[model samples]
Target chain A: MKRNLAQVVLSTVALLIVLSAFLPDTDGGFSGIVKSADSYFPIWFSIIAVFAFVLGASSLIGSHVRKIKDRETDWQYSVVTVLSFAIVLIVGLAKLGGASGLEGDVSDPASVLGRIFSSVLSPLHATLFSLLAFYMASAAFRSFRIRSLETTVLLVSASIIIIGRLPFASKLFSFLPDALQWLRPDKLSLWMLLVPNTAGQRAVLITVSLGVIAVALKYILGMSRDMFGGQK
Target chain B: MSSDSLLLLITLVVIAAAMLRHRDRKSEVDCIPEIEVAVRKAAELNRPAYFIPGSRDIDNIQTISALSMLKVVARYCAEYDVELIIPVSKSMVMERAREVCNAAYEEAGFSDRWSSSQVSYTTDDPLGFVAHVDGMIARAKPAVCFMFGFFAGESLLLAESSYNVAEVTIAGTAVPSQIPFFVASCDTTLIGEEFFAASAMLSGNQEDIAMLQGLDAGKQLAIGIILAVVVLSYLTLIFKPEMYESFLTIVDNLLHGGGR
Candidate 1:
């Protein structure tokens, strides 16, 4: 009974919001209420997100603390996690360094929070991002292995694009005859990206959009009970 | 009503019709080999399975689809009495994931095996979350890892890390740019709409199958319209070039609220 009530309420709200999005803004009466709801929904989400942050912080701290208590493998690392988390939380909330009070900006360059973000967090983020380059190389190596026709095609296309984008590609291709000039790596690469790549991407995009519409309809209609932890 | 609104209404009507038609029908989604392989490997190895329902929060549709897949995965794990670890970047997702997993286990008659601690909240910072997960992957060395949802640059990093440790890594995402990375690194990759379809397929719910049918019908309708427009455009260009400008105007007005 409770699940039925929740489903009805959720479905009604979802339908109203979806209708409001398509309804003309000039419409008055019920449309006005829905339009107001549609506008305020993001703010509601933001409020919820703020509360979720606290939940997230507590979960993180609780997990790490448990690890330390259990003396799990590499439990020592939890000490750094807890310490960093506490220091950042205290510094940010207390408005430490240049920002001495609640009114002061925590983002000020002179503030400890700002320095931590810029000096510590920024570099750490960069270091992690840089790992992508190596990962990409390894991934490419695996993908480009010429075991199948598909992989061979992928390799050839990738090679063309890589060479085509080079600064000396035009000069490199100048020796080719005029009849086969269209095969120039630079032109071929541009065509591959602008035409085939775009067409494929659009095809995928359209299909995905249709799938999204189906999923949205399922949710709005309360057909997806499992999502709500209700019995199918 | 606007054309776009009319189109949406038509779509809804078509989907409703399909749902009604399939209401009493039992439909089955084809087996996704990767899901089976991952589950079997985990059960065999006697190691926990790890699932990342994307880096996003529960609000995103992709994450919701990922959760649906998680329901199936959790059910399989529970039936096999294997543990499943889900580390989420968002607390809301953690909550939803726990509920989904708990429900799955209960449904599988393994409620005693379900625990909220299976789904934990990590940092929300994308890379920080990835770092934490990478560490978990290294330490736990799960038998199989399922990465499904919307992802960014972290997709490759996470997939590769899991690939290195886990016997099987199955990934699905609608992000075009990240699909290649998953394809390269993971044992199985579901690309584009396949990810969404896979979730629906795995659930094997009549409504979901009906929805898939409706989507196909809609796609067919769209293709017909596009083909008609293309043919019309060519005919006009060849036989009635002067009418082309008016044709463009009419199409523009029909598509957008142009000439209003």
Candidate 2:
């Protein structure tokens, strides 16, 4: 009974806030509340978000510590996690290598934090993210077969885009008139991205919007319990 | 209202009428009990629910939608004591998700049942994220997988792995390219606009439904504007080329503030 009442009150308050944000100036009195709420939302969100991180970090650290204490399997991973965490924390906190150029400061490049981030962490992070290019290429190679009509169109479009973007393709197709010039792989590629692509994107946006609304309604009305472990 | 506005209004009514008529076909599984039964079967078989928030940062709309849905999952899971394993790539997203999941547990009055172990984050590497999630599916063997978000190439790998594992996967995303892979590998897939609608549908707020109705209005406005432009251009080409010349001028001046 208490929880249900609380839910009712919270839901009502949330609905009011949403309405005030969207419905525009209904009455004169609402303007102040709307303006103040807008101003407070970001600050509140930031505060909540900062605390959330603290909670997550604590949870992460706590779990690892427990594992290490219990001598859980492959406990060396926890040490690595803690060491990496400390390295990043020290680097960011000390503000190493910042060009702001505050001289003779402990937070300067003279510190170990500065050296680790500048010499190791930054490069490692970049290297990890950069591996996406190779992975993307590999994934595309495996998945982009001409298995269906859609796949065929995708392959052709991708090929045109690739060829058209090259200078040689433009030079080879230069004999065509300006209006008819788009027949070149590059121009056709540009046309594909700019026109049919945008239209298709809009269509998708419409369809997705309909689906999301339906799902959200199901959730809000308690018709769906996947969130509560599919409970009644 | 002007003729343009009138025409747009008419189109919207038609679209709304069509949507209402078509709502029954919205889901393959009509009864709530069936959905519950499916979820139960997955649980009984120890299938993992593959939860993906897309390949973007926490701020992305698709990611937000995913997180919102995950909140629902957390609530239900805690109530029924179903374990959820989320393997996310982005640290910021992990932090936000932890908050959302925790809040959901609190809302469901099952905070004690919720644990950080239920939701985890992998490296910021997309492939690494996929690997970790796949590992969870193997170890935990969740019954259902819910993937909602933006995805690039890795979408197929995740979905196909889940399919091979025989887990029932429900996927939705705003990206068109990822839709096909999800459709092929997952049982039910929400694509494009439906992806957006799924979030609001889960919310079950009347105003959101109205706002969705507003989107159809927005679409109708686009079509009307397109038709007007075409008709005006044709008329100018045949009867008065000079008059058609001013049409572009008016639109440019009005739309772009004459670039002054």
Candidate 3:
């Protein structure tokens, strides 16, 4: 009974908050609550979220240490994890290479931490991101096969976008009129991005909103055991 | 707002109410069947489940949706003491997943069982992350597997690895391109919007369903308004292009008024 009552109250409050997302602000209905909730929740969530970082690092260390203790195979991976973690942690926390005069905060641009981040960490991150091109190229080669009607459509779309986005494609199609040129790879790419992509994206967004509301409702109503580790 | 706009809103609201009323307790499955069973079985098996928070940055909506679904899944794991392994390809995402999972455990009153080690950050390499996740799956040998979130080629690699290991998989996301691999490999799959709807449908709350119903209402309203405009414009084009000119006039007037 108590659980049910609590569920009802929580659900009501949650529904109101979600309701605020849609309620027209011009009417001043639930907009004030929405504004205040938005303002406050981020700060609160952020505070709680910081703990997660600590917990995550600790957990990472704990797991790696366990592997070392247990002599788990691929223990070297754990070593790399710990070493990399320690390097980043120490560089940032110890204020290494900090200015001799004002030598406390390591976040200082000239500090050792900053230098390492700028020269090493930043590049490493970017280098990792650049791998997407390689992965994408590989994925394209493999998945962009002419298999079926749908696959053919995908292949065509992919070709159009790839060709249109590249300068070489534009030059290839440069013989056409201005309007045709606009439909060149570059322009077609933009049109694809703006038209079909946006339309699909918008539809997805609406569906997502509904999903969020549904999940929230399930959580509140206690009908869904996925939240509680049970069956409906 | 014009009378037309007001009418649109009214129509949307009415449709939303109807859809909400019509919503059933069970999910609406279009393609894959037994997804709920797979998800539950994965949870009930009391083993570590792997989560890939997509191979994209935090700005990706698919990643956000994946995390949201993770929230629900994490809560279940917490309640059941099921272990979860989230192999992430982004540092920021690794950080966010930790928070989300922690909150899930906290909410479930299983904070004591919540260990950071359970959700560790793998390298940002997509293939590397896939390898790490696959390794974890092998080591832990999860009973049921869920591959939700933004993914690319790595998705197939992950799913294929799971299938090779004979793990039951349920996958969902909006990326149409990856749907085939998931369909082939996963036990049950949620396509496109259904992936987004999983959290809500799984929740089974009336108000939440009502909101989803409301979205359908909004979509119907959009369709109707579009149809009306097209028909009206077509007729004007045929009979009186001059009358059709007033349509642009109203738009211009609205634009001018809004600017003021």
Best by lDDT: 1
Runs off by more than 4 Å, candidate 1? A26-31, A98-102, B245-249, B256-260
Relative to the unseen true structure, what is the C-alpha lDDT of residue A159 in candidate 3, on a scale of 0 to 100?
85
Query: Candidate 1 lDDT, tens digit per residue, A89-188?
Result: 9998888887476679979988889999999999999999999999999989988999999999999999999999999988887888999998999999
Off by over 4 Å in 3: A1-34, A94-106, A166-198, A209-232, B1-20, B23-31, B34-49, B53-85, B88-145, B150-171, B174-191, B198-215, B235-260
Instruction: Give TM-score, chain B, model 1.
Output: 0.90
TM-score of chain A of each: 0.91, 0.73, 0.71
Worst 10 residues of 1 chain B by lDDT: B15-24
Q: List the DockQ of the predictions in order.
A: 0.70, 0.18, 0.16
Ten-residue stretch with the least lDDT total in model 2 chain B: B26-35
- Please provide, for model 1 over B191-244, each residue's C-alpha lDDT reduced to its tens digit, 9 standing for 90 to 100: 888888889888877778877776777677668767888899889999999999
| Clash pairs detected, candidate 1 | none
Expressed as tens digits, the lDDT of each residue in A35-153 for candidate 3 is 56645655765676566556546656788999988989989888987897798787776667775435477677897778876787678656555644655455455557777786688
lDDT of 2 at B180: 65
- Across residues B1-260, which tens digit of lDDT does each residue of candidate 2 receive? 33333443454455455445444443331222322444566667755455778877654567867876677666666666666677776667777777778887888898887776766655655765676566556655567777889898778767766665655778888887788678656767877766665555554444334445544655665567668878877988799886877987776564444664
For candidate 1, the lDDT comes to 0.86
Q: Give the number of the best model, judged by DockQ.
A: 1
